[model samples]
Target: MKNRIWIVCLACLWLVNNGVFSQEVSPRSVFSLNEGWECRPITTVSKKALFTPVTIPHTWNTSYSEGTILYDRKMMVYQRPLEITNAMKGKRLFLYFEGVNSAAQVFLNHRTIGEHLGGYTAFCFEITDQVKEGENLLEVWASNAYRTDILPISGDFNICGGIHRPCHLIVTGQDCISPLFYASPGVFIHQENISEKEAGIRVETHLSLKNKKEGLKLKTTVTDADNKVVANSETAVTDSIVKQPMLVNRPVLWDGKKNPYLYTVTVELYDGNQLKDRMVQRTGFRYFSADHEKGFFLNGKYLNLYGFCRHEDAKGKGSALLPEDYKMDMELIKESGATAMRLAHYPHAEPMYDLSDENGIILWTEIPMCGPGGQAFTGLVDTEGFKENARLAVKELVYQKFNHPSICFWGICNEILVSDGKKFVEYDDPIPFIKELNGLYKSIDASRLTALATCVDQSYYLGSSDLIAWNKYFGWYKDAAPSASKFFDDCKNTSKGIPVGVSEYGGGASVNHHQWPLAMEDRADSHFHPEEAQTFCHEGNWESFAKRPYLWAKFIWVFADFPSYMRQEGEVDGYNDKGLVTQDRKIKKDAFYFYKANWNLEPMVYITSRRFVKRDNPLTDIKVFTNLKEATLYINDEKIGTMKPDEMKRVIWKDIKLNEGRNTIRVEGKNGRGFLSDSCEWYYIGK
Candidate 1:
């Protein structure tokens, strides 16, 4: 394999003493660096690949195989010019990249500034000493090559390379908030004795100043949703921080999905009564605790978390998604009545956290230190210096997302031993690695708890974290329902310890594949993965989950089908078809509505297998997932007696005779508040 780097910026014109700007723009300014970037792969053999235009938050994998992992693991070089004036002589300038994956080598004026490992976290470089008052070159080399030291060691997802996230140029005065720590907001809010009546909030602000300045004051104000000031405090920047407390008489609680009220906290820096810098942060007041016996209690209400895990990949876009994509995904999850979500295996884009906050959806986010040895072929080998890389990823994930009220738990690891059976080499135990990561998380933020996701055969490791989650595929893999009852019975008797939950569970199915007779046995390894099998698996799993009130949370394996290179079992060769929704997100599988019927409070009725139109049976067991108590079924204009839903919210009408041709089946019912109606057309051929 040949290695090369592209000289992306062919001609970076510099500002000539430069008349571009008269005065040094504004003090402490931040500008978007999304434009004027030209890039080309090092293997470019023609003028077409010679310094082509590209944008920030881009990926070279856009042109690669969307259905599988045939992505080109090449290096992409990006460059842009920065215009500086004489007024910025004393101020410090910094460049911030929200995320860049496998690795990034940053340069200024053709000199290497620094390099960052791990593609999912934010990093910044201080360039005040290297930048000039005119045009300067800002070049970066990014790659998605598989390395021995990065996490994901191996997973079912595609890792694309580029400056795949937003980048910005930040300018700050000598006395301002510090952007040194993972490019995070310098302020951290700590709430104590939190409730509706009264609460205490401590504001911790870290500042970076050029010199020892005098008469610098930090003013803080807490405002509610109505823009009314609730609490106010101000103090001098005697040191690098101004830690103070603000007490409110009555606070509005940020209840999930019910009422997601948010409050804005603004911080201002003043030098001798002149405002120097300002930062506005949004947060909400809420408190939650989990019990293995009572499930999760948020703001003194038992709110069961019926959620699903989400991946950041999209069709043809790879990991590079727009704000509109985020909104659409958020709306879909919200529409499914998912009260919580697990940002699986890694930290998602920052915008997702905000979307969760706005929609009142609880989040369980984690670093990419997942599944034994990180990637494939290691069989549980932590060869990538996973502990250190994980340390940095954890720091970035917590700090950048600390203020978001939607975040409920921090995941330390996921199925670290899922491949423990394939261990071909001797390796250190993962128990200590997970424990140290948990300790590191505790040292920074104690406001939230940390959890670990593990597959079966790792229950003994549950004592390492604040919470434990298991990814079991009992029905799909073991040909039976999940052992949630045994798990709860074994762990629920404890006094007050870690709570348990189901992190990943579901059978895979392609939207186009269907099993007419709904055979539920000996089909685990079937190449013709059927949509009906996925529906059956979900029904049994939900039935188990509904009975076990001791379980705290349940995050389905995935919400959408995602890309995977090594996957060949499902109908799609290069994708994981475990998602409840299709890869294109154009159709929701029957399993999606199974959970909706149980979780959604709205009056709804839907006949499962509406997409399984072709059938070869005279007698069919028609199933309708409905919140309605009693629903009447009619086939070919003939009533089939009204039936009440079972405890699982399912109305099953068995042995329904179908017509020779297309048959119209309709179901109508009324719930506590409204009426529900559903109809499906099925073509019946001779059995």
Candidate 2:
């Protein structure tokens, strides 16, 4: 009993010195304050409104149904009780907001701590002296109203208003890893001196000092994927920013769909051998670049980056996504055979980048500077407030996500020409601002290439960024049926050695609608925007991509249907049905199969236009997508024919006779391993 008491006392002393308690054993430095929060919209600030229980990964937008959902545009306050115990006496306390729509002001015990603008990025406030040893009141004022000073003042997607992300109460020793700069993972690991044999790993950590300034030891250790320590470095704290370089011999590169080798870097701060604070960062080493002549190259191997853009939103969660949601998204993306992603419009949750790193997915991440007209170029060319805010947003974006290896492009601004003064085609140039943003990006992160997404007219502001991407939907909107490569070919001629990419493309599709023989190229008038038409669009567009060598990346407009409150075009009420898959992701449209057939190295076959189950004509074309060399077709248990895939990886039996009532069609193919088959049932009612 006496020995047990001594052991307990020693353990208590050790934990006290480490600035951690029993409740925080899992997340030693961070405690998720996701539970026990009350929130309500604020009409009158006095006495505040009575609050209902809510969780952190929640949004008031979820309370409204499908078409009834309204963008509140009002300020809401969330209050919760935080327990600051006697154990956390000297440790610095930080209230970390993962995300809050538009703007937010944090208060600790009725005292204003700090305010952070821009809803996408994470930010924190130091609340050391503002709390008591017991329970304290923590309040956050969040709003999604139109802020002229914010980056995304106007956008197609609704800016959900609330603490629409996880918040954490971080406790750190006086000499721990700093969350000072935009609440980032203060430690950034840069992969340098790349080769097949050896690589130079540079670890940079920014530290925060409170009562104790010196006599601190910073140790950085890199562990391989197998949890084997590869390299370790320790140095005495001489400055706020510490740079420790480690040489990794025979480094395993992070190859896409091959081997996503990762190294976990653990940064620990110790005073006299007692652990003060610690932070674990997951990172990988790889080399990638986009070429003007040839497409993109990874690890010195040329490869085309084809994928889709994604929004950090779910069915009911708005943008208040969980780690599981992100994980599922990654799994879906992987299943779709996409090698890369464009996290369009805004910086997503941190776990997204981590998942991409683990799954070997390349990424093109950007800020929410989309759809042209904002305070920056709304009639007047430049507003001081807008410029400063834009700069700050870019700074936070680059600084916070600098360590992720999956990101290859830091997209500066997107489709600014929409708000280019008076006209969409011709207006005040936002190139200066673009250039300023690019410069700001380069000032902090020189590792990745910078880019801008343009939709209106690339000629007006294409010269600002290092690389440019076009969100052109020529066939769907105003132009003739694709010749999808036409615009890219024209741009490539005048690219002036600069790489060009197709950032956003493709038309909407209603899973509820279907067309016979696939809609024509110019199907814009097709109000329902049939699913087959969407499939045809993707097929033609990918054919163009296969023919062209200049288009560096091809990201479909979106991966899944997303909500656009003011949108009234597609079959869905308030949703943009441009996704290759349905909003719920329960259905993968034929367009999704077309890409998988061409891109995915997996063994599978799928029949197109299966949703067009009721055919009026007995003689109709049957189409199937397979990466297999050839496929055997059978109609109503009778072998029809055996054919090879065409230039588009499609096997089509044209004008096949269908039975009178129900027609059973089965297609079999040989993959790399063995036989793969797909079957669909169709009703042939004579017209």
Candidate 3:
């Protein structure tokens, strides 16, 4: 039975992948280079270089000592033995690295082939002339050391070292679609104009030709969700580029979370009659805009973006994760009823973007120009090298992710200011650089908008980007909870009208700690982050955010706790506990259900403060989070009063008496779809 079940699961997975953008039939042959690699860290006074067998999707930070923030920021040398066959002699061979740390240098047969500066983006190196048809040595020297030129000079998250993402060996025809253009797929599909009546499309194919020959033409085809060809065109390959335009009448739109229809794009290069190279990708036709007085609109409809900011790091894996891990995270996000996600601090793995496209979850992806938070200082510098590197990183981010329709906003930076004695200071003027990045993104793709996450109270970079969001922590940091609305109003009352948002809000949480009266004091940097405090912070924050439509989007500070080398104040050190869910992806905090009850349409009844099992006060309030209209409270299986939830989906029974010993607390509710119930036990010490 187990074997049969496994086979069924495999079959289902194959069906799903085939239904999506996986290539049906392709001429290119791609191989995984993820296994059997010997790694060693370079040292100053080395006695012996003992290499350890490691995998491609591996990181050295996983072995860091627990409760310590220090990671081994050394240059790691990974070597692998490759045997080239005679059949692959005539084909163009390339090595593609999805991500390597801060820098990487590739060597073939002890000779340097290529080097890349940025870490979070993808890059490829051609190895056609460097290899023979026998055993060859491939070496990659990866380093994560702090560099002044890198955009993220300082961030709250750790810069994990090693080859943290996948690497592939691609072999294709000599005259085929080039994959060397910043490691992109060499094919870009543009939704020139989209509407319910007609859709305009332009397909650009980048080619690598050996000779200028006649009868070489490119064919582009678009297929709808039902595998029906919607539009098709052909154009001659001229000067290593082919552009074809087509139109579809009465097109099906890719709406957000409503329909999310998609169209498959296939580009084939043919020399007269024979096919040479083929590429397959997915794209959707949609239009959106952000109005200052109004809110975000998608496909001529308003969409209030309420989601979470996510970091790619996990508990044991650090930033190195497999495709399955990303898929799991996507499932969790969908389950929580989120319509959008903010890929914060850095560009995540490619699978994350693909999942967003497939699941129709809007994304706000960004580059790694993260700013300093606490003791860390330097964010932006006025050096030529730093400016040049930042320029390249922004361009690469825009070009590589040009075709993903799910990405609607390009975030330039996050919290780009340093604290200076109760005031924040920007030592170097960041407006010029911000304008440069904003212009670069618009030059590449003008369909989407650009955003910046600032921590300063006012609209400092107001005209720098298309939108501006303040990362304010009112109740958790210093001011009272109700002050958030006043702050938003203050920003709106200013002269310039710019689309505003709440980029980061909420407080830290630890499941172990519990307080009855809910400590209203500020403990932003302390280790006593009770679970109730996080719940209270969200309850207040959402109350203000829900009533204001001018606030375009509100992204919770984080979706899951992540590793931060500078943080040492939580249930465990070296982690930021501001996430709605734990780092291991195991437990969802009480605050997680609070948002689920309000945002998700699925019927659910969750008893908050269940982790606070031991209670000293016999008379306490019973709070239940349920999307249902009304829920009934039962104490020790006895009948209690049924109450309706408020506008925030919160139902509370005030001052309920409990048994002296263990008391059974349960809440049952139902919606039009189905019924749900949740139960927990609380042991009363004193009665």
Candidate 4:
């Protein structure tokens, strides 16, 4: 039976009806309070105890767990007590948390102010009322254990707990910009014809007002990077919602591959004479569409989307990543020769959106609900709690990161309801829960495409998404490496009607430093070693196992190997060595070079793997994939030959010349796609 219930009042309605005076505040922080938060474990006797000491940018699991901790272990809570200082006395004070895994409840001097359910989205609370004169006690209770109410009760990877992100107290003016506001630089700019010299530029801006009585006036300006204003407009506040329009005589349209020129739109909010807030958003003046028949098109040009799925996990820091970390990741991604990224599983941290915005990397961001489990569908969807949580997640994500130009698609769920156990097949009936979720996303943000990652089941569930994405691990998990071509053929043949995208594919490899020929055996025994002889011990080669899966575009299970305690064995400890980079971020496995050969566009040098090498095998068959106009391959310092990159054919370079000792092979390519080069060395010995 279908059960229906309204969980919580709409947050906007709640804000208006509460009788409390609303204020507009800037989302940007003036001070860095994230560094000084004092944290501790929440105990049973005191649901809001303040005993443990920790720092900001800290994860509860990394410090608490000595080794790989099982998911079924005891429930843990993280609490942080903050003291309000004189510098933050009069201004409107709010507590902002980038993220909290699973469930979090906030308290000011022991009084419950607000609580949040989802772990991937940002949430804030106005704590001006809870503060004392001199100092204020702020406490946050975060939990990551299994709960029927939580959406992700079961899945791969450890649910590293705590305030797995930075927490801060934002102080702003009485009429400051609200932290939650959607900046839709809407499809104001439209182009009629492409080859023509002049293009039409239409601008549309939406400004949200928190304090209705304050009444806002908006001033918009379009400009080039040189700071010269191209067009400008001014409008007075008539209603809480405002829309303004303007025209540019000749606009430079933004296109994906053919011509990728973007423009900047700046909107400023003013109260009488004082400037209240300002937002600068970058948007392209072009229209595009995606379908199975034509693939991806920008301004009437067909562009095949190629990229890898990125998880928001950083080395050493768990999920609590800083802005610099996001920048580094984006750099690596751009270096990989892919133009886009599928932020796998959930919407990433806000900084990632910022990085993507600046770097021109297209994004496919999804909600946190992932995987296939009975509790995910039966327990989560049927209950009122789960629905409310989902609603909040959508609202927060859409409102916070909507302005980003890089985010092209909003994915609903990961590979959830489409799995058929053996091979991929469709669900018997439409998962009403998913339908409701998709409806909510469409209602909130219809500007972008709606996508979902399913297993191999494209025929039955293609109707559920605007774009059907498949997560196939044929070469690694199911089939052999040599069968990759067959898998691709199966994918193409089966996904005839749907606009298909390979969402995930890749294998694991341990680091050279951590690599011992006997390490895999040690790891198997340590993790899977049971108390009784009935326990079965399985042994296998880890490196050769990973080499077989590096064959496709949506490849690479992970960019780096991370810590995992579940199902571990032997000397493996807590590490899952499936990444191109190692856990400590020091070494690159051979697979990294294989991908570099396939992705890197510049003429550069890179060492693939330092581990096992075949004796006297100086000439390694290096695979170089490029979108450049042409590419040149060289062995040692000598030039070899040129080649072209074709979407239909995988580029493979065979029998490159190598020296007897340590020979380096390099390839350089250039075009509008930019320059790329890569090199690797091998030792040779002869009788």
- Output the number of the lDDT-best candidate: 3
What is the TM-score of candidate 2? 0.92
Off by over 4 Å in 3: 1-25, 44-48, 418-422, 672-674
Highest-scoring model, TM-score? 3
Instruction: Give the lDDT of residue 81 in candidate 2.
Output: 95
**Each model's lDDT:** 0.81, 0.81, 0.86, 0.58
My TM-score estimates for the predictions, one after another, are 0.90, 0.92, 0.94, 0.74
Tens digits of per-residue lDDT for model 4, 505-550 = 5555443232211122222223332111100010011122223232
Candidate 1 clash pair list: 101-119, 149-384, 152-374, 153-374, 153-375, 154-374, 154-375, 154-376, 372-416
lDDT of 3 by residue, 266-309 (tens): 99987765677898888888999888888899999999898999
Candidate 3 least-lDDT 10 residues: 17-26
RMSD from true fold, candidate 4: 12.3
Q: Against the true structure, candidate 1 has what lDDT?
A: 0.81
Winner of 1 and 3 under TM-score: 3
Off by over 4 Å in 2: 1-28, 44-49, 63-70, 212-214, 372-381, 418-428, 519-526, 671-674
lDDT score, candidate 2, position 133? 95
What is the full ranking by TM-score, best candidate first? Answer: 3, 2, 1, 4
